[model samples]
Target: MCSIWRTLQRGTLRDIALVCLAVGVIGLSYGAVAVAGGLPLWVPVLLGLLVAAASSEFLFVGVIAAGGSPIAAVLAGLLVNARHLPFGLALPDVLGHGRRRILGTHLMNDETVVFALAQPDLPRKRAAYWLCGLGILACWPVGALLGGLAGTVIEDTDALGLDAMFPAVILALVLPALRDGETRSAALAGSALALATAPFLPVGLPVLLGLSGLVLAVGRKRETEVIR
Candidate 1:
């Protein structure tokens, strides 16, 4: 507990709080959508607590709302979230080992990963990762609970512009990653594949297909090797 307090005082807490505020707002939007789509209030609340992956939760809720089968929804959610496999691979050091790794994996998300990677050193990275992760874990579920209850009263959350927040937040996150040439190339290729396939494919499949962007990364690596 004392260590936690010290961690909070270390200054990354402010950034974590700010990001979690956005996450909470997004969580509220997600809860409202889930209830409005005919899910029980507890569904979104539970998802916020357990699933905790905003994109996957949104995709799952959407599939269910569209009358997709539960099995199909689950598969879609898994497909959409498959990128986490690479994330886990890339951050093995930050994730640690044994019992702590279980909690670390659960807390892993785009914001936490980005915040941790942006830090200058290993200690700061670990601190930012855990702080952002734990903070989001708290804020997300609370926001979902409140939103689920309020969802019954509110009819059109889109009018409040919450609908735009998710993509805007995602774009903001990806923009920084694009600073790297290889990453930028991969993103462009992935986006093109996603867009081209979106009309004919199911929601999550486009994202899965976008994984082909790794080909660009491979090609970039080979080119760099040749140049060297």
Candidate 2:
């Protein structure tokens, strides 16, 4: 295992490990919430491994548990993960070729992309990307398994206040990006639109409507780029 991760520097290793620890905690919450909501233990565990996008998984679980259609849940998940299109476009080299590319894409998330971009060289970028991605892959499922087991013994998840955790964690994850003016504007607009339409629209459809705020963001970005 040490040899496998020999390419990562000590600082890189430490930062990635910290991120893994945080993700593990979020995964634990996801597992506990899902199981307590009446999902099978395998459901959350399998979703953790397969979906690998915490926010999207949370949205899916929330929608489904609220009596939304499976299609609606899946559409919401897709909308949340659409950011990966840009992610893939920016990191083709780190994704390698053929089988490695497939696995790299599967592991591709915001954390891995940010770490890869922060590195000074391509080799270091690849090292950081794979290290962080692999770390999260391992941590998420293990945490989910433990949380699922714990959920089995807990009789009242709502009383324990697990219900509010999904959105709270999602908000925490996106809070860092909101420091940017353009992103913040778009987020506020999108969020307001979603909340407004949520009363009349189907569970997942409001999220799609929320995405319309991206047009304003894209237009603003273009204006700024032209000015520069």
Instruction: Tell me the tens digit of each residue's lDDT in model 2 across 1-228.
Output: 464377777877887788887788767777888887778889888988988887788888888888899998999888767768767998999988999899899899888888887777888888888888898998998888888888755445467565565455446556677888888999888889989997986555666676778787888889999999
lDDT of each: 0.82, 0.80
Tens digit of per-residue lDDT, candidate 1, span 1-228: 345446444456775687898889877778888988999999999999999898889899999999999998888888777768877887888887899999999999888888777766777678778888988999998888888888855566678787776577557656776999888888889889989998998666787687788797888899989999
On lDDT, the candidate that comes out on top is 1
**TM-score per candidate, chains pooled:** 0.81, 0.70
TM-score of 2: 0.70
Root-mean-square deviation of every model: 3.1, 5.0
